[model samples]
Target: MTNHTILEPLREDQWFIQSQELRSFLAKVSEISAHTVDDRTQTLARLEPYFQELLVQQEWLPQKFAQVNPESRMGGGIGQWLLYRAKNQSLSIFSLVIPPGSTTPVHDHLAWGLIGLYKGNQEETVYRRVDNGDAQGHAQLQITEVRRLKTGDIYRLLPPDGDIHAVKTTSQSASVSIHILGNDTGCIWRHQFMPESHSVKSFRSGYSNAPCEEEEEKEHALH
Candidate 1:
């Protein structure tokens, strides 16, 4: 079996800093998500407008969270920084920074979420998995769409349909996108695909700012 780490929910909501804009957005998301908890489609639909509003507001995100990480967990100078996570672990907000000319591995987010370009530009290549998933460590994916997204562009991840994809920064500077997900995205094990090799593997791209349980344990041991 693939080794996976399960993280317990935090005792209280965690915020990197106190920002009124983020607080207001989180409140709206919580309110909308509570009622439509059973239906992910409706939840994402309801959350889109609020997410769009957050994306359009430029000054809310601090520069530190938007900067690229040299030791990126996702590689290619892709930094995933956590800004906020609900106490129950049902909601999370983060910024993904991709340096210019860098591309993320084709990956899947196994939860419903919204990804919006906060700065710069990106080329997103969305894919569809074709195999039945019976074979181990193997997956076949076909490109469904290639989208060029500029600042303020938004997209949705509704799984089994528009889930698997790769993104590359196509601008002079790094591209920063905001992700509001239903799960603790970077901490949980997900799939990363190798299209040319027709292979897949379990991957956990931990946040640059927030360490996972295993990472925390290692840090304690080293001290």
Candidate 2:
């Protein structure tokens, strides 16, 4: 467990700083971010091998980093445990846990993202929007790559440096990943593609654990 004294500076978000292991990971992120900021190539080059190693060697996160109850039907469907977020929305770090047979919609992040698979198996498919509409419109898509990621695997999606894809949890056990995105991912609206309609719409992919007015009201009622 991490010393409680170290968590005071990062109290705005939900995090299990008690885990010394997770704290070490966060420390590594901070160190890498300082040198790699705004440079996708640098970020990938420096962080890629680091996360790749983490996927292979590290195991275990605090209980709080997981679903409240492991067998509780995965209450929120997909679990995204927010750890730390920058005030300027420049970056956001969180853990995403997907239950077996579940998948995120085909979506694109306007900003860059780095995904590290911490546990279980993941299958992701990357797509490119191909539209005959004017020079600016994207109407259809072409599958670029289908990656099979196992625990200890890492990949980046830097609009210009990489591709966009949706992830599916193929393991019987839940799959967990650590996501570091360029901006406030939950607050910003991004594009979600509909292959069947050959269309795309702007939507926000909010995490399940984000605080909101509705949740506050429920808490106030109970109080």
Candidate 3:
């Protein structure tokens, strides 16, 4: 099995600054509070434009980045690479490569998030956390819904909708996704996804897969 090389560079900042579409997204996002049930539906609506913009600007994302099967050793498992960050507020962009026959463990976000699919197809299983801890010390996690997303699609996950889900990539290639979240100078916590174990945990750690040490060091100094 040969490693599938990314022929194109992962372009960031192509869609960072505020645009007409981004402004519209922000409007919808402003309507929902992190503390309310409306946050789920509103956030998804707001995220659609960003995803659309990314697809329009970089059409090759979905066509070129397909999910690879781990068995074939052609593609790797789900991993993240942070693209950019700023003072006060930070932007984190990551690519989630899901190999065929491999799925992400169910998890939820500690902060607001937006996801867009660049290539292939994926099945998302949404879950809700139940507060009633069973006698076995395992918390009750419920599967609420399942959604199938294809290339050039986008969505949002928030705490209000109980945004815990498992993603399974379609066959033929690896499924790649671009995720964006706000990280306030490492003040915001990160939500970790555990697919096999079906759990998510929160942490206040710095970006693990940031672009480079020198760049990260500079950013840290400014913060």
Q: lDDT (CA) for every model shown?
A: 0.90, 0.67, 0.53
Clashing pairs in 1: none
Q: Give the TM-score of candidate 1.
A: 0.95
- Evaluated with TM-score, which candidate comes out highest? 1
Can you rank all candidates by lDDT, best first?
1, 2, 3
Clashes of 2: 2
Candidate 2 TM-score, C-alpha based: 0.76
lDDT by residue for model 2 over 1-223, one digit each (tens)?
1111111122354453455555666577678877878676787677777666555655455546654223322233677776667655566777788888788778776676688888889999888776754533345888888989898788887784445578898999888888877676655656666777777666655555664334456799999
Give the Cα RMSD of candidate 2. Answer: 7.5
Model 1 C-alpha lDDT per residue in residues 1-223, reported as the tens digit of each score? 2635456777688898668988998998889889998898898888888888888898999999989999997999899999998777778899999999999999998878899999999999999999998899999999999999999999999888789999999999999999998888888898999999999999999999988756777899999
Candidate 1 lowest-lDDT run of ten: 1-10
Q: What is the lDDT of residue 52 in candidate 2?
A: 65
TM-score of model number 3: 0.59
In candidate 3, what are the lDDT values of residues 31-106, reduced to their tens digit?
4434344444665565566557765555333332233323321123554433344332434454567876677655
lDDT of 1 at 7: 69
What's the residue-level lDDT of 116 in candidate 1? 95
What RMSD does each model have against the real structure?
A: 1.4, 7.5, 9.6
Off by over 4 Å in 3: 1-47, 59-76, 132-137, 184-208, 211-223
